[model samples]
Target: MGDRRALETQLAVVAGFENPQARLEQYPTPPDIAAHVVHFADLQGDVDGRTVVDLGTGTGMLALGAALRGPRRVVGVELDAAALDTARDNERRVGTTTPIHWIRGDATRSPLCVHSDGNSETTVLMNPPFGAQNGRRGADRGFLRTASELADVSYSIHNQGSRQFVESFAADEGGEVTHAFGATLTLDRQFDFHEQETRDLDTEVFRIRWT
Candidate 1:
């Protein structure tokens, strides 16, 4: 599942193969990206066979990681077509019996937000926009609103740069940070392009539940 060539192709797809990578144009998450997965999985407490949702699931990194945790079903919702393609590919290449549903839509506008299919024991793991530069494009306050009504529990990702917004937004979402950790501790996990010496940045992994 962790094939090198497959991951390489995914990276190329994320980089737009032909276009230059720019924060202003397309903001793809770093390679491997294990911290968010760990954070969410931790907040999940004990999924066992519960359903899980992964928002802004680019390349299916977090979604796939959570799937390995034995969720009955895992859905990865992403807005980018390229990212969706890679996500589906990763599910096929890496392998998983945990049903994977990859939806093509922005995290803020979840197509399944209205679902009432009895998967109430659901958990969501999200890595949303940074609220920097064009970060608000397709990502805004609405995302938190949607999540509150959609899942019983969630783990949302935000950088120190957006502390004020995250704090306020979490309050509005009826959720709060159950655990906060430096990205440095997170970078300690497995990754494609992320490892020690990557960054000393700070990010919060908020375990949001009925605030």
Candidate 2:
């Protein structure tokens, strides 16, 4: 119903993880970036009346954005119970009429079944871990895999310099990268290891069509 700025304003109320895990790389997706992705998807005709899934949906930023955009239903999968709790709270704060199902499970190995015939088309939205943490390389790979298995299309955000990896993965999985763009992820230092009060991360977003 609103423009991207309006969506970003709505999502600004979403809460981040109360106790973020370093291993999970649990930084919240910025409201502006979430708005950008959601609005782009909406313009592409992928959101309204679709079954939108947000994998690793920490605090429901992307999921809530989709919910506000008139998705028929939304499913948010996260492994942390506490994050899911916050997501529920954020859902209320966003005040969207769309129904959202928040599930507690690993997004990499999602618990959702593939859509059956006559079911609404599935579209996935995620800001998965960038695998920048120690011993956590290739973290976003699993998210992509899950999207391939469950969605007709997916929009994902990843660390910069990921185009090659993402393109390769999509080709191998029988998916095609239809849209690519760059964005800035601004993070206020939440964890102890951060050297600055705020950090601006260069990031990329990809829209993939899964066969």
Candidate 3:
């Protein structure tokens, strides 16, 4: 509703995961980054009056950000029940009028139907797992695959050096990368293996238009 700063302020109250799962790379998206992405999407005429879906919505950060905007409806698909519970609480705390549909299911194989007719549009937003963990490589690919199948346009975050991978995948899926940008993800130590108290990860965000 307001500027990016105002949106960030509203999202400041959104909480992180209580019991972080290492396998899922469960790190909360920074409020500033979320605000920036949502504001950019809004400016591109992607948020308002569209059905916005946030895949792997950890505590509803991006979903709530879009909700505060003028989206017709929002859907958050997450596999973690605990995370979804926290997301519901966050939604109440944010107190946005836009309705959000929280689905407790795997985001990669989301149970959402495509609504990409000329009259209606679907926008997918997500900060999917970066495939950092061993044996969990190419994790974000599944999320992108889902977006390709279900979204008219999609915005996603990935590791710093994933530009080539993302571009290649998007091209293969009949999508074009319209925009790309860099960001920093500050992650606090939430797992046993983390040696540092906090780590700053260089990341990238991409906006792709599916044809």
Structural similarity to truth (TM-score) of each candidate: 0.70, 0.98, 0.98
Given candidate 1, what's the lDDT at residue 53? Answer: 83
Tens-digit per-residue lDDT, 19-78, candidate 2: 999999999999999999999999999998899999999999999999999888999999
RMSD score of candidate 3 (Å):
1.0
- lDDT per residue as tens, model 3, 14-125: 9999999999999999999999999999999999989999999989999999999998899999999999999999999999999899999999989988576666599999
Error of 1 at 18 (Å): 8.1
Sorted by lDDT, highest first, which candidate order results?
3, 2, 1
Positional deviation of 29 in candidate 1, in angstroms? 4.7
Residue by residue across 137-201, what tens digits does model 1's lDDT show? 43545666667777776766666655566666777767775555444223322334345544444
Q: Is candidate 1 or candidate 2 better by TM-score?
A: 2
Model 1 CA RMSD to the hidden true structure, in angstroms = 6.7
